[model samples]
Target: MSASAGVVVLGNTYDFFSRTRPRTVRRLAGRGQAKRARETAEKLLRDIIHAYDSVPSLTFRLLVVEDVATGGGGWTFTAENEYKVSCTLYAAAYYSTQVCVDDVLDQILNVGDRPGSLVPFNHTTTSLRGVVEAGQWVAAGQTLSWDTSQRGVEEPRPCIKRLSDPPIYRCVHEPEGVTVAAIRQETGTVLQITLNPLEYCRIGKGGAVFTK
Candidate 1:
């Protein structure tokens, strides 16, 4: 499946210019104007969120400040403070539609059949039911799931990973379905769930259901 990425920017454009440009009397006068533009952008972001939040499935993350840069272009007299205010607050929204498409691609690639079903594993009351270690051999079930309720993938404690912790699958019960999906959590918990047929389903725990 095709992967997607997003970026969000938030800050004062005028302030940025004022701080970076060759300071002088004329640039000082434009400070107030730059502030207003920054405020306007902030308000616009809020309004956009308000408008879309009414929709049932709409969700977003403000990943501002991940990377900041400054640049300017215009007629000669453009001072740093006078440079056009360009502070931007960015956010990304992924809908159910895109998720469905990803599922299709995973199926075609036979990702489910990969080693270790790659489900969620962790130690949280809400996630793993307070157990330090939990395992199951269900023909299906989610070993783990993530709490992406927070914004940005830049957190030190990421919800997803290429590595596994407490690394072992101790099955308490047979997998419920033919396919399974493992989701990692921010709190170090792994959520493993069995997937429906036609999805990226894993059958490593051994059962001759059908061909991949």
Candidate 2:
């Protein structure tokens, strides 16, 4: 049983319940509903403990927040080439949505800093904190991508693609006044989204990707 360095700085509804609810978890005594809250908090703590178990010793913080007053109407997402060689990708997209506190625990497993883009929330709190040994802390809402020069790549050439999907999903999306780029298909059964050098695509794969 190893110890967890991740600390839960704020428990959900702690301040709210403190002000509105008369009794604390310890004072709940035989109050059934309050007992349930205690159980839920314990479960959340366990989940948070596991989240920071492998985040490497770096300057990082997971700030969890949820409020009803404001949220993003839409979002922009991007990614870039992590390698040295320049490559041409066929397609790209940007998708994103608001982050919710109910899914914070699961975010580390799937979304991480991607969904941390929401604006400042007064009621929000830092639920977990850690220190990484090597890398600096990345800012919230910024995907890791490098700005690279496309000087060493082959010149853009005329290429064509033909699809043979008979009974399947078909889609086409492009905005007016914007020139469309290359169109490609997924590699085998695995989906392969390509990004150009110093480019990235941000998609809202946050809370929606988890089991509700």
Candidate 3:
């Protein structure tokens, strides 16, 4: 990743719970339910932002926040060109009944740094940490190495690769996909799998159309 690499971040929240209750139960329900719910939602937003900052790949950018009020439902997240990822929190609480529940949905845009390259499916099982590094290829379905338990017991595991699903961003001229193919030794780079000439042309042109 380049030092100047950047990724967009977004966040939003909504609440649907009410505070009105029967006169007899008003004492139990009307005190702090809404306040708690809102606080929880806001805290979740902050946590999402902090998480984005923790990742080394992204230099955080705080774009403008746009909100809309819905009729009993939460708002939808709209992705703009600048927004590469979004985290939304939806909270509902019954103030009159002291019922509170909140859910968080994180939609990561641009997928990740090495989106087009194949990666080890079960990295936790790979024991060659720091030794193997990325961009090296073991035979398909072959055991690259073993992972050890806390007690230092080794368990064998195989190296696997897969094509990453595209994310909500402009598709650049990245390698088409990755496989269990050979990695270039001099550069420690994984070889991208071959594709149809037409598709290859598309990627090579950097999103431009080629004349017939």
Number of colliding residue pairs in model 3: 0
- Give the root-mean-square deviation of each candidate in angstroms: 23.7, 24.7, 25.5
Better of 1 and 3 by TM-score: 1
For residues 1-212, could you state the per-residue lDDT of candidate 2 as single tens digits? 22332222232233333231212211222234423433453344334323333323211211111101111111122121121111111222221112322232234333344354221111233232331111112233222211113211121222222331211111222232221121111111111112222211111213121010
The best candidate by lDDT is 1
> Which regions of candidate 2 deviate over 4 angstroms?
1-27, 56-111, 114-212
Identify the superior model by TM-score, candidate 1 or candidate 2.
Answer: 1
List, residue by residue over 1-212, the lDDT tens digit for candidate 1.
22322211122443444343423222421345433544454454344323323323222222111111132333334343243222323322211112332232233124333344232222211232322222322222222122233421222222222332111101111112211112122122222222221211111112211111
Each prediction's TM-score versus the true structure? 0.26, 0.18, 0.21
* Deviating ranges (above 4 Å) for candidate 3: 1-32, 63-69, 72-212
| List of clashing residue pairs for candidate 3 | none
Global lDDT of each candidate = 0.26, 0.23, 0.22
Error of 2 at 79 (Å): 47
Per-residue C-alpha lDDT of model 3 across residues 46-131, encoded as one tens digit per residue: 44333334323332222111111111112233322212112122211100101110100011112212334222222333333343
